[model samples]
Target: MAEPAGGPPRAGLVSVVIPARNAEATIAVQLDALYRQTYPGPWEAVVVDNGSSDGTRAVLRSWQRRMPQLRPVSAPEASGANHARNIGCRLASGELVLCCDADDIVAPGWMAAMVETLRTSPAAGGALERRSLNGTVALAARPPKESDSLLDTFGFLPYPAGANCGFHKELWRRLGGFDESYRYGSDDVEFFWRAQLAGYELGFSPHAVVHYRLRDGPLAIARQLYCYGRSHPRLYRDFRAYGMPRSRIGEAVRAWWRLLVHAGDLAATPERRSAWLAGLALRAGRVAGSVRHRRPYL
Candidate 1:
């Protein structure tokens, strides 16, 4: 359980993978956090810019001069986050891979914690928590439980937010990286499940934290919920089609329902009733996905 040797002494060389599209506004903040890390190990940030028409490229260029550790790679194909991440992983030279979104801020000691945990544990990966804009923090939902057997963990795998997870380079390659067929969310879930099924252990590290910035407006929140609802059935269908267990469908449905009921919690004012309405719209999308995929729920 000693720290993995023959790499950078303190922090190790962690390739921080960032997949971004039109993230001109927040990418700088994320990079700033990376540059300021208190963990003084050799590391690099590989940002894959996926067909951003905005000034995202320019912003990255601006930072490249200021932050030598930042490297921007272009992925103009629009293949999605998974595609971009794969590109970054291939280009990365570090022994460890840490994934993050373009819109998140990592804590100062984030990389240090992930390196220490992965080095000491038998886990193929480590999970971290995220703090939402409202200052509410929640564990990244993956692996179902701390004591889950490796295979069962695959059955109910919860993913560390792509923004807050870390894994060894070789293990990532063995799992074949994220499946690009899923152009958005759930790719993380699918990849993690496959890794667990293949006998790789996954664990959690509370210190590797990030602040997730939710969209500022209620309408944006509603849109995000709607997308989640629409993606649920697709996730389940893919899960079953690939021969993984079909256990989480009911949980997905409940999540949709909970979102509908708690839409008010995200709204800032009574005038923002549209957010709740939007939540209903998202719920309908989830139902449609369920029916189209014919995924079973009890």
Candidate 2:
């Protein structure tokens, strides 16, 4: 578990895989941040264009001139971020692979921290900061504070957020990559959980921070949270045999009751209204997901 050793061959090459889809507006910023990384190690950005019909390819073409290590590939066979990640990782030519989202910006020295952590840990995830890229509305809509440690889902195994995670190339092949079927959220959660169940240790690197982006508007935030909630039921259904905890009916009832108690907040400030909408949407999604996935989660 040491840093990639110096050698004539591609010994220490770190491949940063990014999955992009119609991210023309934000991807350039992400690529700019990647170009400014202070890792000081040999790293390549393997950007997989996931069927973007916009000017994303144009943006990538422009950055290619600025970033010599930027290699853009197309992944039209599949439609999800996980699918693009799988495609990008398969084509990556590096000992270590780091996966990040196209919409988020990595902090300077982020790569260095992740590589430094991977020197001792099998797989690692970084801290996500919401304050940097988000405004008051987006921040208020999603109030959960980012954790320095890997997230523990449903009282189950700790898993890394897909946006800022790194692992060895061999481990990715062994785990058969991410589940492409997970078109929604929690793909990273499922992957890391499976990795731990298969005997690999997942670690946290607080110094490797990624400035995570929140959805722009109330509707966008609702959709994201609903998709996340819907995905959790599917996760529960798949991992319950491995002792994944189930959602409690009492808790669900209490959650609804609390929402009702705070119904007045919907008419208050924009921040309060956003928070109320987000809470209601998430719970509704969980209920809908339970029915869709045939698992009584809520």
Across residues 137-243, which tens digit of lDDT does each residue of candidate 1 receive? 11111112332122233345655656677787777788787888766456667777777678877877777767766554445655665655666677767666666
Model 1 clashes, total count: 4
Clashes of 2: 0
Please give the lDDT score for candidate 2. Answer: 0.87
lDDT of 2 at 88: 79
Each candidate structure's TM-score, on Cα atoms with residue i matched to residue i, is 0.77, 0.94
Error of 1 at 123 (Å): 5.7
| Candidate 2 Cα outliers beyond 4 Å, as residue runs | 1-9, 144-146
- True-structure RMSD for candidate 2: 4.4
Tens-digit lDDT track for model 2 on 52-88? 9999999988888889998889878789988988887
User: What value does the lDDT take at residue 210 in candidate 1?
Assistant: 72
